[model samples]
Target: MKRIMIVDDSSTIRKLINYILRKKDYLITEAEDGLDALEKLIETKVDLVIADLNMPNMDGIELVKSLRNNFYHIDTPIIMLTTTRDENLKKSALEAGVNLFLNKPIQPNLLLYKVESLLEGEKNE
Candidate 1:
């Protein structure tokens, strides 16, 4: 089973994503923020990461940078799921190493599709 880490400060958002992805039988890991995600990632390796942009402790861009700098996670696919419409932030996120940038209130099917695509692509690599 593919493992996915969902990093969001909101419990409701985390649960919602878990509920949606659970249908696909993906193993889910939840983190309250980027810092928690990084700590957990040190012990648990995930196939992909879905993170919120504006999280306390460490935000999405910072997390992406840290992950990119880490040898273990340098090639991990990251999806920034944020509600922000700021082009500057999005650009920074992409530069920081996020593979994809998705807005909040995302469609379940779309999220599933992207996750599947990213995992499949990684497998091919």
Candidate 2:
């Protein structure tokens, strides 16, 4: 089973994502923020990460940068699932090494499709 990490300060959001992904039988890990995510990452390796752009301590962009700098997780797929509508933040996320940017209120099916696609792409490579 693929392990996925959901990084968001909101407990509701974390549980929502966990609930959605659980349908596919994915092992879920929840982190309150980027710092929490990074700390948990040290002890648990996840196949992919879904993070919120606005988070306390560290944001999604910073998390992407940190992950990119780490050799072990440099290639791990990262998806920024944010409520931000700012194009600048989206651009920054991409430049910082996020593989995909998704807006909040996302459809569950769409999220599943994207996750599967990214994982499949990784396997192909």
Candidate 3:
């Protein structure tokens, strides 16, 4: 079973994603924000991390930087989700080491597809 960490400030979004991934039999871990997610990562080993761009107390960009700098998570795949269409923000995320960026109002099938593709690639590697 693949483990995934979801970091978002919105409870509704967290629950929605948790529901979707749970149905696929993926182990789900939820964090209210980047800070919480970082704490969780210290104790939990996750195959992937799905995070919202705008979050309090660190934000997704900072989290990505932290993860990339950390030896344990340097190769971990990260998918950043955001409602913003800002090209600069997207560029920043890419530079910060995000593997993929998905816009908000994400379609369930698309999310699943990306998640599966990334995880499958990881397995192949």
Candidate 4:
């Protein structure tokens, strides 16, 4: 079974993604912020990470940077989810190593597609 982490400050977002991925038979872990997600990652190995950009005590970009330094997560795909339409933020995320982006008010099908595709690519590598 594949494990995934959903990192967001909003409980609703976390719950929604958890529900969506759970239905697809993916193991889910929820984190309220990037800091919390980093802590969780230390203990578990997740195939992918879905994170929100704007978060307290560490944003997604910083989290991605931190994860990239860790040998265990060096090649793990990170999908950043956000409502921000700022091109600068998107550029920063890309530079920081976010593999994909998903806008807020998420479309379930797109999320699943990205998740499956990233995981499949990981498997192939």
Candidate 5:
């Protein structure tokens, strides 16, 4: 089974994504912020990461940069979920190594589709 790490400050977002992916045979793990996500990642190998933009203790861009440096996860795909539509923020995240972006108040079907596609691509690689 494939595992996904969900990094978001909002409990609601974490729960919603966990719920959506559960039906698809994907293993779900969660963190409340980027710092917390790092600790979780140290203990588990996740196939992909679905992260959120704004969070306390570390925002998503910093998290992506951190993950990119860690040799074990250098190629892991990260899809950032954010409420911010600002182009600058998007550009920063892309530069920091975020693979995909999903705006918040996320649509469940779209989330599933993106997750499945990323997961499939990972398998191919």
Candidate 6:
């Protein structure tokens, strides 16, 4: 099974995502923010990351940049989960190497579809 790490400040959202992704048979891991996510990323092998933008100790954009600059996680898939729908932000994220983006108030089916598609693509690659 593919392993996904969810990095969010909200405990409620974390639980919701964990529940939904677990049902799909993906191994789920979580972090409270980008810093935590980085630590987790170093500690284990994660196939994908779903990160929130507005988080303490570090934010999603910074995290993406860090991942690119850091020796590890160069190819790890990142799916930005954010309330900000600004085209500029989306463009910047893509430039930073995010694999996908999911808006806030995420729909379960859509999340599943995006996750599956990215994972499937990775599998094909």
Query: What are the models' TM-scores?
Result: 0.97, 0.97, 0.97, 0.97, 0.96, 0.91
Regions of candidate 2 where Cα sits further than 4 Å from its true position: none
Q: What lDDT does model 5 reach? A: 0.92
lDDT per residue for candidate 1 within 4-107, as digits (tens), equals: 99999999999999999999999999999989999999899899999999988999899999999999899999999977666779989988999997888878
Stretches > 4 Å off in candidate 3: none
lDDT of each: 0.92, 0.92, 0.92, 0.92, 0.92, 0.87
* Overall local distance difference test of candidate 3: 0.92
> Lowest-lDDT window of 10 residues in candidate 4?
82-91
- Candidate 5: residue 62 Cα off by (Å): 0.4
Over the stretch 1-125, how does candidate 3's per-residue lDDT look in tens digits? 99999999999999999988887999999999989999999899999999999998999999999999999999899999977665688888899999998888978888999999999999998
Compared to the true structure, candidate 4 yields what TM-score? 0.97
lDDT of 1: 0.92
Off by over 4 Å in 1: none
Q: Check candidate 5 and list the clashing pairs.
A: none
Per-residue error for 58 in candidate 5, Å, reads 0.7
**Model 4 segments beyond 4 Å from truth?**
none
- Pick by TM-score: 2 or 6, better one: 2
Instruction: Assess the local accuracy of residue 95 in candidate 5 as a C-alpha lDDT between 0 and 100.
Output: 93
* Clashing residue pairs found in predicted model 1: none
- Evaluated at residue 109, the lDDT of candidate 1 is 94
Question: Model 6, 77-106: lDDT tens per residue?
Answer: 789986665567777778888888888898
